[model samples]
Target: MYSEKLKYYEFFAGVGMARAGLGGDWQCLFANDSDQLKRQSYSDNWAGEAFDSRDVAEVETTDLDGVADLAWASFPCQDLSQAGSKAGIGEADGTSVTRSGAVWPFLRIIRGLAEEGRHPALLALENVVGLLSANSGNDFRSLCGALNEIGYRFGAIVADASHFVPQSRPRVFIVAIRREVSIPAALRTELPQSPWHPQTLLRAHAGLSVEDMAAWVWWSPGAPPPQKDFELEDIVDLSDDADWNSEEATQRLIGMMSELQLNRLAAAKAEARLMIGSLYLRMRPNGDDRNVQRAEIAFGATLGCLRTPKGGASRPRIIVVEGERVRTRLLTVAEAARLMGLEEDFVLPETYHECFRLIGDGVVPAVVRFLADRLLEPLAKHAKEGVFTTINGRKLA
Candidate 1:
């Protein structure tokens, strides 16, 4: 359900996953990425026109055709991911390491778009939940400032795929629209509130609250409510597409564990667990929004935020649910994709590791689609309508 009138340009276009999620109607005027293999994957899935394949940092604005009606950027989160080595803007070994803090370059892209008046009507950004807390929240502030400078208003929500599916993957989605849009007045009337009302994080690290860890904030007063709740079931595939050496890895992990730690893991059916979660989920601050309902804790029903390691074969304990029992295993790439609303049919690379890593590193297709339908389409409509009001002051007719 795309708005045919709008045009799109997918940046950091990983395997054309976003393009696929957004569907066929919206014209893909341009797509950019640095990986040749990923470009091939994209070419296989999308073949009408030849897209530009180059580093986003190198591509000039003049190289692209128009300003585009929408721009999708799930920029590399290596520097901003909690699951990554805590390099904190310092150079590290792995690509996922080294906090490049590249939000500034992306901001330049937006500014370029805005300059030509061909900038997208909506900008959709997705990243690990850690982005909100990394660097004492300075990274987030800079991003907000950049958007404000570009004359766009935005709202961010930290959601998990579990709400839409059954998987416990959570991520933060930021949606921005050009302030010139008029339809938000009507859209604002329909926005929904966060389920876990701005409760502070009980635990504090680098001086941040639980609420600071994950909370949806709206810069635009009239922004629409969140509609991107996904669950594991929505994106879970029934087929096995991974070659998991769980036995060896588990044995090695068990060999490395202390006697007591070994006993705890050995008692469980699954051997490997995500070690990063412990680092990420610490205790909340004292006497903050300390209201824990008798039911939420008992049922483990809180909407767990999405982690950057959702696709890692080696990290984060993977648990499988059966009739009554839950078992643990390494989550498959397909399952990870499904959790993000990216189906196997989307044509990822053949290498299991590459595909899994890439999908895990990418954004949820379903959520992206939801943004396209609910936010992007409406923004475009508002632009086309050319009227603004805090409330429904003008009729489409």
Candidate 2:
């Protein structure tokens, strides 16, 4: 079965979350990331595995052990995200020259593999949903065009982490198959589907050249496997041993909230059982349109998407209410890991910041597994049978 249960290369492989999601069955031939803390955590959890800690720019073709059945890359999204600088990976003509430009190196490695006739049968890219509109949609076109130039047909699915976890993170997965690999028509839809193909995605596709559109497939991976509701309260660490904030600190947090936020907290406090809430301090406009810091809390159901602590407010604080008492604390590394769909046994970074950043930068494993079960497995099955589809584009370079 596709070289005995599929093999993959994990690029920009932040802490091997993709590998964790893919699980033990899929052999990981190579993995690379530049972060020291992430490298340490990844090595700890995935010992005896080939883990390359070099920056993507420093990665050479020889570092790759062999041709993989798939390559999953979760490249940097800071430049493309609103939480960071929205500078983006530049335009179609050139990409970001900074570290955020890691996607280009990722593409280079894939292209290099193709040149050596060792290209993987499939490639999956995960990044912030902002990729769809980054640089006014040109970046999306460039990515699609690059795959086309390398002789692959591709599509995108906007998978939200909340579907599989209690975190409200929506990421875009650009799943591509080499032109020669046979994908059944069942995976394609004549019309764009909702949720996966949002209006922004449709607009991005319409802006593409006709040639790229022809190479495009509106991937229909079917509804995600029915997952029971994963609520904010379900994954939280509510025991007293948790690093709950002190009485003074909790009161200070409450003091910073606006009227609306206080009302939400009051509503949550009125609930029949203990309440779990997540808080994020953000810059919002006052009556005069002047920016002011405000505390915002999501009372139930789901927490806002986790973000690395680029700023103090970027990290979320958790609040708990039981009877007449309330407590608050920074999101613990353990809770952060669970929010990312990591099991309790998974080794995390040593410090809170490191672990939080690792989890924040990671993709949800359960979501990945869901996609693997429905989309990737079928493609591999078709590949093993020598099911063939012809390429309509000429290979470049």
Q: Give all candidates' CA lDDT scores.
A: 0.54, 0.80
* Position 326, candidate 1: lDDT: 31
What is the C-alpha lDDT profile of model 1 across 1-397, one tens digit per residue? 3334567777878777677768765778888887777788778777666777766667777877864777888777766664465334332222433434444455677787667665666787777666666666655654655676687766566555554444455666677776666444544433344532122111112243333322223422233344444333434333344343355654443444445443443344242422111101222333676732110010122223334443222332343333333333445556555555556567776665666656656666665665667656766666656653322243221
**What's the lDDT for residue 185 in model 1?**
56
- State model 1's lDDT: 0.54
Clashing pairs in 2: none
**What TM-score would every model get versus the actual structure?**
0.68, 0.91
Best candidate per TM-score, number? 2
Q: Worst 10-residue stretch by lDDT in candidate 1?
A: 292-301
Residue 329 C-alpha lDDT in model 1: 46
Candidate 1 residue spans exceeding 4 A from truth: 1-3, 86-100, 189-192, 196-337, 387-397
**Which portions of model 2 miss their true places by more than 4 Å?**
1-3, 91-95, 231-234, 287-289, 311-313, 322-324, 387-397
Best candidate according to lDDT? 2
